[model samples]
Target: MTTPNELRLLPWSGSGDKPCYLSTDDPDGYMSRLADSIEAIQLGTASELLEEASEALDSQGTSLDDMRCLVKELTGALRDVYRVAASRGHLLTTSDPREPTY
Candidate 1:
């Protein structure tokens, strides 16, 4: 069990996924190495999805339903990429002040 003061780094998630924690006391332990592997795999996947999304935009048929679905999946993948960056303490890109968020 993790102490209240300890950080529980949940680099992945869902109702089925379990929380992963590292002992701050041992920075290079087995669990720490495993977490590092998992984070790398996840970030690699994000890169692949980004590539796919770019391809999807460039070579797609003119079907409204398909376009909508592509946009939806791409949006989700981009969100995951941003989340991973944030968890790693990376700064998010600032949005244009004049642009509408919606």
Candidate 2:
């Protein structure tokens, strides 16, 4: 199974295809487009995992420890993705009026 953090581009490998270059040609716009793509996949996978966890928990009944742990793990996976993205500056922050923390 592929880990959430790994980048997979099938049919392409290093040194063959021209690499994706994030240049000063249009930094913010380039980063914004990258961020949008990241958000789409990250949010999509997170949503699916959360839904699966919810169904698993419901089927297993309340007070199930394993289900709770699974939910936490899934949540952590998502948090880590966002944290790394922000650290890499793919996400921008403003301090004026402040936005939703999440």
Candidate 3:
């Protein structure tokens, strides 16, 4: 049985907006590689959205409706970025050599 710390949080969610996890010993496996690709894409999207948000904020001609739409997209991107960060953080903590394994 795979432990929680050993499970990798997938880049996407399952039904009902629940988190999905991958349990695999092979980091180079198909699923793991797919997840890595997705995470990279998500992070890239978030970075682009952040730049767009900054531009919008600095522009005096930006309309309320445009800002609202940008906010919605930003919210989704932020969620994905946060999930990636959390998954990476968990992996780090579990695999860290400095931590004494029980």
| Candidate No. with top TM-score | 3
51-90 per-residue lDDT for model 1 (tens digits): 7667767875547777787678767666656556664552
**Candidate 1 lDDT (Cα, whole model)?**
0.61
Measured by lDDT, the strongest candidate is: 3
**TM-score of predicted structure 3:** 0.91
TM-score of each: 0.55, 0.42, 0.91
Q: How far out, in Å, is residue 95 in model 3?
A: 2.3
Candidate 3 residue 37 C-alpha distance from true site, Å = 0.4
The 10 consecutive residues of candidate 2 with the worst lDDT sum are: 4-13
- Cα lDDT tens digits, model 3, 1-102, are 358668999999999999999999899999999999999999999999999999999999999999999999999999999999999988887776797878
Off by over 4 Å in 3: 97-102
User: Pairs clashing in candidate 3?
Assistant: none
Measured with C-alpha atoms, the lDDT of residue 50 in candidate 1 is 73
Q: For residues 1-102, what per-residue lDDT tens digits would candidate 2 score against the true structure? A: 223332222211237653232333343565546745765676677778888777886784645687777879797667746544553553233233356655
Of 1 and 2, the candidate ranking higher by lDDT: 1
Worst 10 residues of 3 by lDDT: 1-10
Error of 3 at 54 (Å): 0.7
**Which pairs clash inside model 1?**
none
